[model samples]
Target chain A: MENPYIVEPAAITSIRQETDETKTYTLKFVERERTLQFTPGQFNMISLLGVGEGAFSITSSPLQKDDFEHTIRLVGNLTRAIDRLAQGDIVGVRGPYGTGWPIDSAKGKDIFIIAGGVGLAPLRGLINLIIERRNDFGVVEIMYGSRKPDELVFTSEYDKWRAAPNISLFLTVDEVPEGFEWTHGRGVVTNLLGLSKIDPANALAFVCGPEIMMRFVARSLTIRGLAEENIFVSLERRMECGMAKCGRCMLGRAYICTDGPVFSYPEVRSLPQNLLAASF
Target chain B: MVKSTPRALKLENLNILIDAVSQKYRTYGPVAKDGENAWEEVKADGELSLGCAATMLPAKHILQPVRLDLYSFKSSGGFQIEEPGFDEKIALFGVSPCDVNAILALDRVFGGRFVDPYYWQRRENALIVASNCTESAEESFCTSWDTGPELYSDYDLLITELADGYLLEVGSQRGKVVVNGLNLPGATQEDLKEKASRLDAARAATKKRLPVPPDDLHQLFEERYDHPIWVPNAEVCFSCGNCTFSCPTCFCFDIRDEVKPSRKEGVRNLEWDSCQLLEFAEVAHHANFRRLRIDRFKHRTIHKLSWMKQQYGLTGCVGCGRCVRWCPSWPVRRGRITSLADPVEIIADMLEPPEKVEGVERPGGVIV
Candidate 1:
């Protein structure tokens, strides 16, 4: 009986400026008791009244029931319209859709979470879940990088993540800007894989970022003696309808919206592998 | 439940059946207009263009219109959507066997995962009267895919043109209602034997075929992603998207928001879009996934021949040959002036050994 296209109204409660181009908006359903239940990597379709609709990752931790969060960048019409709105402004929200990260499969394994720029936003919920249940998992290592020092999101939570037992955080910037300050590793996120102490015997890697970045990370993990089946990557596509019917987010047989926003390296390899193509 | 017996109706009593169906639903049938067959509303006394396979378009336009409004919205207050009404109940009379196969493929696309109420509203409620293809067209290759010249499922009524008269096969209980009302004579064993011979001749008439077996097609596309044949084949592609528009199985669509002059209200519509267009895969900042002519060109051919089978159980192309007949651009092939607008031409080239020519490699799954 449910129409997937119909959206429930959610009011933006607060907005945090993550960078010059990105902002994190916290929202709650206007109906008070209505809340969207979701896992770490799943996303929601947000809309601006008459403008348009766009998909955003549910960046909030799964435990947070009263509200949800989405870190959006100034990419297109809907995001631009969303950035201009003040707190308490109501917008249409229609998901928490997609197969999220396989949280149960990685329960007893070492977790290696890698991200780039705003790509870290989608993984933030998974990171929070691991930190909260640190005893349920093994060693945790977080590697993230951005083109510039100012582009890194969730900087405030880095120290807290580092303070957690058995969790190591490695931050990097493609290049530190002039007059701006940065003290972590420099160059692409791939440069820090040499220092990672993750043992391939019992490890699960969750990666997300621009399509190009995930490709490099998957290759780096494979080169480090990790099985293709063990590495999980989040793919990006031009999704209009979160449902599989849109055909926009298709990668071979997989409809990125329904089949995955998340897929194993081996599963992705089995597809035609055009869009995430490797140089022959 | 008693099985309905097949009935034989003389050529003169054809209108009696149409009039019977019209009592329950608004009926539409093929009509000859300017030497081309077009689907038009058939009144009780209207002349039906039976025994024709020259319709310019398929039944897709009937179920999902070229521009169907999903809903209307107002920008003044909170975000809201008002779904359009689902009122009209339309039925098809004398639909081709190839198109019936096309409707089944579309039924899976819209009926799976999230059922599209808009498409099902028309497809489920309306009755279907399918007619087998007795004569093959110039471009039709439906026999290669086993989707034409005969139909086995998804029709309420099946009509086959016999040498002397018409033989009606009631495929469903609904189809029997009309035949029983007319009280037509039961078809003789000789008439049934004539139907089999007619379809066999129709199949033999189709000269074109896909060469490659259906099971091995997926592997072919995988190994030849960067085949050198795509370059020169794409050289004269105008990207006009005529092939996709005329295709019976090309179901890709793009959503558009038509804002009013005052900017206070708008209507959201989903229009059939072709991958051949540059903007079909455009994302933010004008970053296109299939920017090049070859990428868009190869995607359409490969998706239909291979990827569609992987996505859905059936191949997206029913070999209706609409793409071949509708293509506007005529690129040359071999030594003579030939049409390279057909999917068969490109897919055939990919199936063969690659020629040693300088060709650009196709881009990987790149993000915007």
Candidate 2:
């Protein structure tokens, strides 16, 4: 019997500091025979053995089979333990669990990707897939934001993504540092939605960030003539067993672990308001 | 597979059946536990109490234990994972009809899209021996849910009490194995007629009525999602989690890893969890989804009565009434305490329109 509880050990080959509070670990499955084929938006339950486990979105695309990456923010006990690990350290890995982004369904449509802070991690895979099949999609637009210019992740990859044909990239910071020589707009990411030139009716928008940010961006897109069904948002909930069995991640009827991490605005509109509230 | 002809066992031969079943498997039945009846391991015939009104805890603990080791890991040269093994062949004796239904509901949850291998392993190795309820217990509403007094299916063996002796019906091949050497006589048409009347009397004895029919809950609850009843009712709730702990079909759990003092090895455990707890939906960053007590209170009932059916095609509650009996905060009305967790009262109140306050002006300063 395949015990779903078992975590396969993966060796971290390298680590890159994305920000002061977050790092991206590049790992390869210890057993070379194993394949980590994960779709965009699907998350892996990464475990730092003897410490704890957490569910993180698989940032590296399935297009690269040999090595996968998880961009982790230093938040809780498990993530903090993960951040302390050096290169060549082995961490237990399980999953590629939960439903992924509707890549196949959104094909041939203009794709609008909106992300904030480290929330861009999950959408990174989807963006890569879209760029790989560049011709398959219409004009692709990505608007990413961070608290400050220094907090942004994947800074080096921004230029490469912008260089792609028919793709426009926009970056924003909530508060620009005084000493930083930043040239981009400074405000909440939703402020960029009005400047984005994509026709909302023709585009499928994917938004992941703070719940408040996602709500505002979703509202902006809807106001810009995007259907509620066309706008997607990723929900962040407390999950123990990434499987729905652990009810900690319940969003009314839906278990955020299995039913979503990704849900359309219309799908979540019926859910209780407290799930997406900025604070109690 | 129900019996074409039920079997009969003399009153004195009850021990013979217990001995026959326990010879091959560990038998468990309702037994005295700290002044209350509970499911416990029974070795002797005298330890079995088949007629106990209701066990404090449902027999679900046999399959889904309170603290289950999901998996354990060791750090030798590299990491090796070990899954917990379950191979105990056990037979649960004297299970109530509602509890049996609860097991069936749990089967749908753990057996849905991703089959819970651990739960199924225990379920596969276990046998069920159901005992009929001759009279409905206080606070029980099994009759309202079609889950008490008699069971239609899913039992290995069902024992129906009669005036003289017990009518034993074999519902599966495993049941046949249990009764093979007992030399019990085949039940006659007269015994079947007597059994039907007894079940009918027991069903009539149950007075509790569900506020809404199971079929109409989906539509009714969808309309009452924002009903005002949720606020004041939940305000008095202690959020103690007694309702969930005592619930038969509540399968919410929390996963955690516990390491040894040496910090070399650890086991990931899935502990039974309750949605009523404030931290149930709290994330690491301190953002709680169901932070308000009212939301948690509403979540428990909605998940059980409405959402579980939509998700798994089976109701999460089996009308066992354990939550009602075990709740510490249930208010007494006319010297009779009614469960606040009762779907009957909760839904009835939600269906009614909110009381109109006369003197207070509306938020916009508009008064009706």
Candidate 3:
């Protein structure tokens, strides 16, 4: 008899600064034998003792069993508290919840990964998995953009990602600040879609970012002739219980926490106008 | 298996059944609380009021308590979690038929997909003594929803108030155990027939009805998503959340951890939350998905009238009419809150002909 509300203690083994406002925390579950067994694109509800909890995507690849990494940005109260914690600090970890990216299902299809700002965190897992099993996928294209040069995460992994065979990495900065030596594509990440060579008919797109970014990226992919069903978008919603009981994260009939954080473009498009829309 | 045969209990002997049930379980019955009928713990038979009026709140507060501790945590332990369950068994007496249907709907929600142990702990141990609605309330439309005025099943004991006395129909083995030694006389065929006829009359007398059919309601509401009725309706909505609080079928909740002042001890509590609040959809970075009043209004209406039906096989609203009766914005007409706060009326207004309006274009129908 498992109680879903129970939170397992996880020790923060290491922490690495990803950007000015974001850091990646490497955690090891205290219960050594307990395998999280989470797929790429799934999130975990990380609790900071009495502070509260917030859902963060597991950036670590599923192949890595010993440790899990979560790239968190300092946005709200919970995230700020989490960012203040150092190595050896104990925190509550519940989940490995929600629908993950179509890793196995998208095999042999050209994978197009598009992200913006801190939204790149969840997709990082899928990128790593695809690179490890490079033979299983077609040409993999990664397009990521940050608000500024200092806001870019995983600066250390950029070389490794680009070095991977069949993986083309496209990095961009929304605006270049003075005194910052930066050489990359300029403007939003979706702008890179025109510069990339992707066969829409044979490609599967996975998008994660701000709502507007996803809408535009999804629209671009669809206009490029990709099927609406083939384009998946990861959404962020107010969540209390990772299970579907709390009604906060509901988008129409679907509970984003359970039904998906990863939903096909057609599924999101089917929701009512007020649920998710251009102005909304 | 238990017998479905109707049993007769004289008006004076109603307390005998209460006394019998109280011997085994803690009884909860409707009592006058602050000039309103509410379910309260009954210490003696004198506290019970088998009122014709509907209770201000449903029995869900007992089954699924408003603020429940999922577990308590102490700093001394190695991050251990403790789960608690209700200790005492409860018998809820005199629940309305609409509320009985509400209980069934809640059972499906908490029992399905992920079983909520906190809710089930009280639900499994509790006994249901449902009473049929003999007289309709001012805002009741339970008959239109085909959910009330008579209890068919889903309850342990059934009590139907008749002209002379009460007709007790034992539904489950637990119900028979409560009335065991009382030796209640079996109801005659005439009494049983009379109960049916009276219930039929009560159902017909419930004047209010949903404008759309049950089967077509989901599709109709889906098409009315962008209808103009939302703006003006939401404008007057204070967002006080009384409507959801009073609703028998509104089951939205929030779970949070509350720590003691020492910060060494804490408890995770699940409390009822309404979707009408602006902060209900607020996520990280202060981004609220349903920020506008209209967005929240449409979400609540669509979720209850349509989406829940698609998800759970039953419409989220049982037509208990509590929302219509309790909403602060509910228009008072002839000393009673009329259908202005009724969801049926809102949907009806949404479905009105587009030509009636001067410049507003018709909200084109779309089906998903």
Candidate 4:
């Protein structure tokens, strides 16, 4: 068998700018093959022929297989190249790598989602997935925060999320702009956690955001009576190879690429290496 | 066991053997420098430096190149993923037994679990010719680790300098193939016995030892998880990752894709990576795990001594002392062994923990 580094062609069908710096690209199988099968939270290694390759989480749920979505922010070289791509442009994609959110275990349980900035991309997949099977889950709440109102992503779908009876959507921003009409909470995303009426004793929380933001959010949840193990946070590491071989993404013996991009707060806390405050 | 007599070969005859091997293999051997020795690829027997103690770098470069192109791709949606192709065999000559054992240890790692095909390809087609050490260097501690100046099954042949020429012992089929073709004198029983005695004396002469016993290494590290020793000792770590790069047993790497300027062609490359690097554990949202220099330093030691043992049934460190010698930091100096704490005390604490320790509580809510 060939090594997993093999690249296959993927065609971009549409592009939607989520924010000034972040965009969501929709890709379809150019060969007309069956839709790509991947769970929410899993990512793909996207290659722009002469530019470079980067790992981006699938922003679309597994339930939607006809097409897939990748939410990318203009951060470095490869991402900048991807940001320049237009509809019908061809790029190389490998994998639906890494483990996804555990939905089966979330059945009949209340789902609490907390996101910050572009961290919402992966959580958006889970939200859409849960919404599709709305009756299968109990009270669903989403608390999302951005640096500013203009930075909020998926603005087109906010209205639909607000109208859903089974879900409660709470949005927050760090600061309000002059002459801007804002009705939602205006503090950190963790501040919106107080507006939801779910019982922490029976709810599972999934959080993704800036490291500092996630730390505070986790602390808030713990103080609110949520178990440390009940809170899962997605970690972003400098992953060159999304395989276990590369020691780049290692936290002790566990490789983030193979073991997890998602880990419980207690698990992360136990690793002495995981709690270090400086850049790795 | 079928014991073969040791035979002698002149330096000239040895050169011919190397030349013949180089015809079909990439030959690597020791090269003498300004009163020192280093291992490198040699094209002829004249380049062999049998008198050298050890190579500056371990032989890992043969199996795991510093930089390797994993795959290449072109525009028009066409690409090619590179596969492991060991077209040329390898002949490693004048390797110390310690270095040979280091490769064997690496074999247990890269050859199992994920089974690195690239390493395996090179390994399958390679031959190891180890040299029996006549003297030990000041920093050498292979004897303490049970890896020594003598030979093992991992080598294809074992060579020792004799009174007039060199003693050659065929260690494998490949060694026998080379020995049968060499125009040299056959050996007698006395020559075999004398060679054995010389090897035994070399083993006995080794004086260096690791401060900590290998058996107690795991528990020692576990107990020292919060010990102050790591903090003070690791303060000097520069995090340059030179220690890992020069280590024979360290096989960590990073995979990346590089594209041509025209955006039409690209290649996936695998480069040597080290956990000592600051970004080794930084995640997507810029959360760096193992951020502190102390944490990174502790990780390298813990992984080599504890984590690798648990995962692979063998310690990751091969007692090569490269990390100790290569680290630029003062406190990070190599070969300074520290004794392990008692295992019984550690186990007792775990079993007899305080009933009311602060900040220790079970969760009362659902776990994700």
Give the Å error, residue B83, model 3: 2.6
DockQ comparisons of all candidates to the true complex: 0.58, 0.66, 0.57, 0.31
Tell me which of candidates 1 and 3 scores higher on DockQ.
1
Deviating ranges (above 4 Å) for candidate 3:
A273-280, B1-12, B51-53, B76-78, B331-340, B358-368
TM-score, each model? 0.94, 0.95, 0.94, 0.81
Model 2: runs farther than 4 Å from truth? Answer: A273-280, B1-13, B51-53, B332-337, B356-368
Candidate 4 or 3, higher TM-score: 3
Model 1 lDDT per residue over B1-368, tens place: 24345444544356877888888878988877788778888888887776535678776888888889888887555666788888887879989888888888788888887888878888887789899888887687787788887877778888888877787888777777766767677788887888889988889998877777767778887888777776777767778888888777777787777888887788877888877888877888998766778777777777888888877788778888888887776676544554567766766777667765445454422211
* lDDT over C-alpha atoms for residue A162 of model 4: 71
- Ten contiguous residues with the weakest lDDT in model 1 chain A: A271-280
lDDT of 1 by residue, A209-263 (tens): 8878888888899888888889998877777788877677776678888888888
Candidate 3 recovers what fraction of true contacts? 0.54
> Between which residue pairs do clashes occur in model 3?
none
Evaluated on chain B only, what are the TM-scores of all the candidate structures, in order? 0.91, 0.91, 0.91, 0.81
**Cα lDDT for residue A65, model 3?**
82
Candidate 2 lDDT tens digits, B1-368: 44244445433446777788789888888988898888898875556666524788888888889998888888864687777677788889899888888888888778866678888888887889898888887678887778887887888888888888878888887888878877777777788888889999888888877877888887877777766566656766788898898888898888888999887798888889888887787767776767778778878888888898888877787777888787777764325666787777676767776564122232321110
User: DockQ-based ranking, best first?
Assistant: 2, 1, 3, 4
- Tell me the deviation in Å of residue A158 in model 1: 2.0
DockQ of 1: 0.58
Q: Provide backbone clash counts, one per model.
A: 8, 0, 0, 12
